[model samples]
Target chain A: MDRQAILVELKKVLAPYIKNKELLDGITENTNLITDLKINSANLVDIVIDAEAQYNIEIDADSAENMVTIQNCIDVIEEKLSSANS
Target chain B: MHSAGNDVVAFRLTDPERSAQPRFYNQILSPSEIALFHSGALPSLSFHIFLWLCWSIKESAYKFRKRYHPDLVFSPTAIPVTEIRATAQQITHEGPQNASTDPQITGTDHQITHPVLQITGTDHQITHPVLLITNAAHQITHPVHVITGRTEDLFFRSELFPEGIHTVVYRHPDFKSVRSGYAFLQQALGSNHPQTNGATEPTPETQSAAVRELVLLDLRKRDPNGAWSFGKHKEGYPLLYRNGVLQPVPLSLAHHDQLLGFSYLLPVS
Candidate 1:
């Protein structure tokens, strides 16, 4: 899947966890999960798990740690999806 | 508790804004932890506590590791929580006749009873991943033994404020450990130092300094000869010592809204 397509699914996974709805609406590839959406550090796990189930991909420890931004999430999902397809 | 090689963490659970964010978990937890959350094995409240529990364990483990490897950097994913068992604290409330019993009470003038959280747990087997620092690296897959202790409570004067979770981890299971010195930030800053700007809502750094001082002051009473100097060791872990001698006694520090605390193992004689 492409970045835009992955972002759509990402938004769905993030909606419930984001405290700032305005930030969520304006979220882009550059948006940071902690600074922009003000997501609590604890809920980040839920997003990772949800993203895996939503996109049907697994995120490793290193990738999970680097998944601080929306773009990072998209990159990991895309990579995982492609690798699985290959 | 005996303090030889133990540490504790006190975190504020009052911030609804932070608690709502989903990205926060990524910064602190490992992959297996996320799976545990998905497993739905623990209750909602227990799960929430479990999150903090994991955080405390990592934090405590970091403190423990810092003593041996000062350059060790803390990455929650790098440290895995192996086992945890719920433990109970037997608290006996013996105080003044009416309300004002606990001296650590803040935010209100009226006397109130402090509710000690029932469910607290301890974990002994927490593993630290191989670390690679600036020009210095160490790899150890061996799981380090750490004893973790936790407490959760919601302090209130009128309205119920957010719950605070306090946790301690000891390098040696037999070592005694404790976390104390709860103070209001506003009151502590004003009385401790006669500075001009007594900002009610100080930054996290400011709050941490004030709280660290209060905790250190309380710690000093136990060992009058032990002059604790603060500095960063190998991987920027905070170091403390009594007198001029370098002490291996592990110490952990934390500060959050309206609270700051320290946990350490008392040096074994």
Candidate 2:
């Protein structure tokens, strides 16, 4: 899947937990998942679960630790998606 | 340094090398953590709630005694330097008789009664200092204190240490199905359940739920209706759990909240 497509899906996963967080409106590829968007880590949990469902992959503890930044999360998702296809 | 939106209150705590710096340091709290408190996701405790406790008696020690909101110390990152028993004897033999002659310290020598943590004091090096948490609710049930309401004492002390290892007197009767770190702690501490051990086993979902319930219980006044409430409680602040009893988790597998970053202690050794 393309980067844009994955980011769009990411937004949907983040929607529920980030209430009134205008940062969501400005979310972009460069956006930092926690710092920029103001999305709580708890919400990030929901995002990961959502990510697994959309891409049909599993995120383990060690690998998940790398998803600190938005770009990092996207990279992980892309990696997962690509692997699934191969 | 300012990555996304984390209101990074930069502190020098993480680096052991700078542990000797005379300057006081600060650190940034994570985003989800910001949501936990500021969002009113958690409640705040009022002085009135602690009216009957010991800190209430030592009015002078309260920094601002007559004031409505008395000042309380919130020291986090207190290092767990093995068991205090071994360390205490060593210190006693080496130190002077007036171990707590710091004239600034007041009241019934809280320094002695409390447990000592080998934390990086303001001076910065990882050194031993006694933790004198005077919260009325914590440890009230310990046999010595003879305080009532087992659950109340247990819940407050639960704030300091995660649970397990050190046994506190009061045991809060927690309602089931609660979600939060505090809830998990209560269950973990109370749990002698065959399969689980505090630091050994990863905190199960059941334990997290227990922690959440306990957090709500500690800040009960703010969360009158329980879980559904969505806003900051009294202090209108989402202060980071000072010691970070939980933290720096792999944001991948766990929910930000569920990640349980280097949070409160569960006794590793």
Candidate 3:
């Protein structure tokens, strides 16, 4: 429901795809999934699917594009959750 | 303005089933592209590879346009693949023999036993040997698909490989002067390059360093005596320098899993 909580859940969703554990441990809102974590672009789709199932939210194409960074992912998840509740 | 961009998708690292799921593939491919896929244009490639091949093309086009539009965000469905043509390349190796005397096969020491694919409509050519190594002679025929696509006003060309796919974007067909290459990260790093600085680790930092080093190596091969270096433009795009002067060459680097890809424009003489 909150940004921090969403970040924690996002980390769980990303853990399997990211190969660098050290970078994962230090991930911040500014951290980029492709550049910082070295996660392959192909895996980004998996993360999106995993997050959709994890949070029970539907992410459209526009929202997925913004999911490039950790903060952006949190923002998209938060927006989707709030919109669903409303 | 001269520029080039490329992207590589290592299919082995991708999940074929997940990639084909409607929920996932829908986010990437538009309705028209899905219909195009159903048209059986590329019958040899699976649905998942088709999806990723389009993604690689769009991603490369994005990189090409980002030089002028730095605020661009990559929305795969927004970039469309308008045309696709497939051709089979039959490569046969009987045994160790003399390499082809064709000048087009520049700098090739390995032998090519069969005729290469010659596609019409575009100036399709392979300046480098298709098979880098042929220790044991064998025969095989593989399907290579050429895809043409556009993003806004920009156009791109892509080729499918056994393991992955590569795409390059250009403003015009005749204006497309970009040369591209792809190799395993380990192979690129295995070659001694001073930029590695003796660092052999496969970290994200080293991965990017290896790409730059590989591009520099290619540049040096073209002009042996040129003093070359790599730097980034103000818009965050990669650029090359020769003899302390900024060269007009635009460079794009991409690495995923163990694969590394790069493309650059040759400076006009």
Candidate 4:
């Protein structure tokens, strides 16, 4: 439910595909998904798949376009979380 | 007349040495948004399943790259390629007669077929994780170079990979390419140039919990009907012959969970 917790969980699922050694070591929140973490759009779909499976929420195709960076990915999750809670 | 008919039937049954029918499957994944995967900064984020495939290919390349220096590729099918260490080609095959030259290999002519991953199943997996950058031959050929990279810089830099690709460029061999290329993507938000590379290999620091298999082949000379099959290697690599010399070609790694396809064929004696 918490944004940070959700982000952490999402990162865990997405981590396997990413080469962490290329990123700044010790990843934490505020890591730029695009620049710092280097998450691409194609694989982002897989992240979306993993997140939906984890939290059980469906992310629409249009909304996914905005989820670019780590922050964007987190922002989208927060939006989905808030909407689902309401 | 009856005896002749029986002899033909017997010959068919006795030829146990015949090769199995080659397997081929259609691409199961989509062709949409493939450029997006290629444009990313680090391919690791999007090409999750493919990362493992590429790493395995790179490892296999190391075994033969130094010793054999393989030049031609005969992948019955080609898909988006990510892992290559150092070699000449990225060529895929159409068949025995139609070995179309890779455009990258045509002009320069300095090519080694770096890690050719031949299999019957890429058609099903292409669109699952990302869009493959097969050489333009996908339209006309059996094997394709779904995607390719040359120098280290093009892979890691942002400028090199535009649009859907910049953010993933952190792992690209160059950081400046990212800074320079993104100058416009962030500012004008208009125009995107796709920086492509030639040979790419996964470094030790980058690979993850990927699963792959190693297989061996024995290429004893002068036997056209002579085929070698061993039960030990779960993943099978095809052996190639060009100009009367033999070359070893690797198939993709065997998955652990996969039930052996031809388990019953092993000789009891």
**The candidate that achieves the highest DockQ relative to the unseen native structure:** 3
The residue ranges of model 1 lying beyond 4 angstroms of the native Cα positions read: A1-60, A66-86, B1-44, B70-78, B88-91, B94-162, B177-200, B225-228, B241-248
lDDT of 1 by residue, B1-269 (tens): 22211222223332334433455565566567767666754322344445665665565555555555544444666776543432222333432112122224211122323432233222211111100010111111213432222221111011011234434444333222333334445445654443314433445456658766765666565657667777656543466766766776555565545544455544545
Question: Which structure among the candidates has the greatest lDDT?
Answer: 3
**Poorest 10 consecutive residues by lDDT, candidate 1 chain B:** B129-138
Order of models, best lDDT first = 3, 1, 2, 4
State candidate 2's TM-score: 0.30
Worst 10 residues of 3 chain B by lDDT: B134-143
lDDT at B163 for candidate 1? Answer: 31
lDDT (C-alpha) at residue A10 in model 2: 79
- Tens digit of per-residue lDDT, candidate 4, span B1-269: 00000000001111111111111011112232234335653333424322332322222222222122233231212322333221122334321111122111100123322222222232222211122232222111112222223221112110001011111112223222111111111111111212111122222112111111111111222224554443223122333343444433222221111100000101112
Q: Which one is best on TM-score?
A: 3
Better of 1 and 4 by lDDT: 1
Task: Indicate the docking level reached by candidate 3.
Answer: medium
- Report the first chain's TM-score for all candidates: 0.94, 0.85, 0.96, 0.74
Off by over 4 Å in 4: A21-25, A28-30, A38-42, B1-201, B204-269
Instruction: Provide the TM-score of chain B versus the true chain B for each model in turn.
Output: 0.56, 0.21, 0.73, 0.18
Off by over 4 Å in 2: B1-157, B160-269
DockQ of each: 0.10, 0.05, 0.70, 0.02
Per-model CA lDDT versus the true structure = 0.50, 0.31, 0.66, 0.29
Per-residue CA lDDT of model 2 for B1-269, tens digit only, reads: 00000000001212323222212111112223223323432122111111111111111111111122223221111111110111222222111112222111111212333343333322233233223232332322222211222211122221111111111111232211112221223232344633234344332344334433333343343336433212222432222231333221110011122112111111112
Runs of candidate 3 with Cα error greater than 4 angstroms are B92-151, B191-201
RMSD of 1: 12.2
Error of 3 at B250 (Å): 0.7
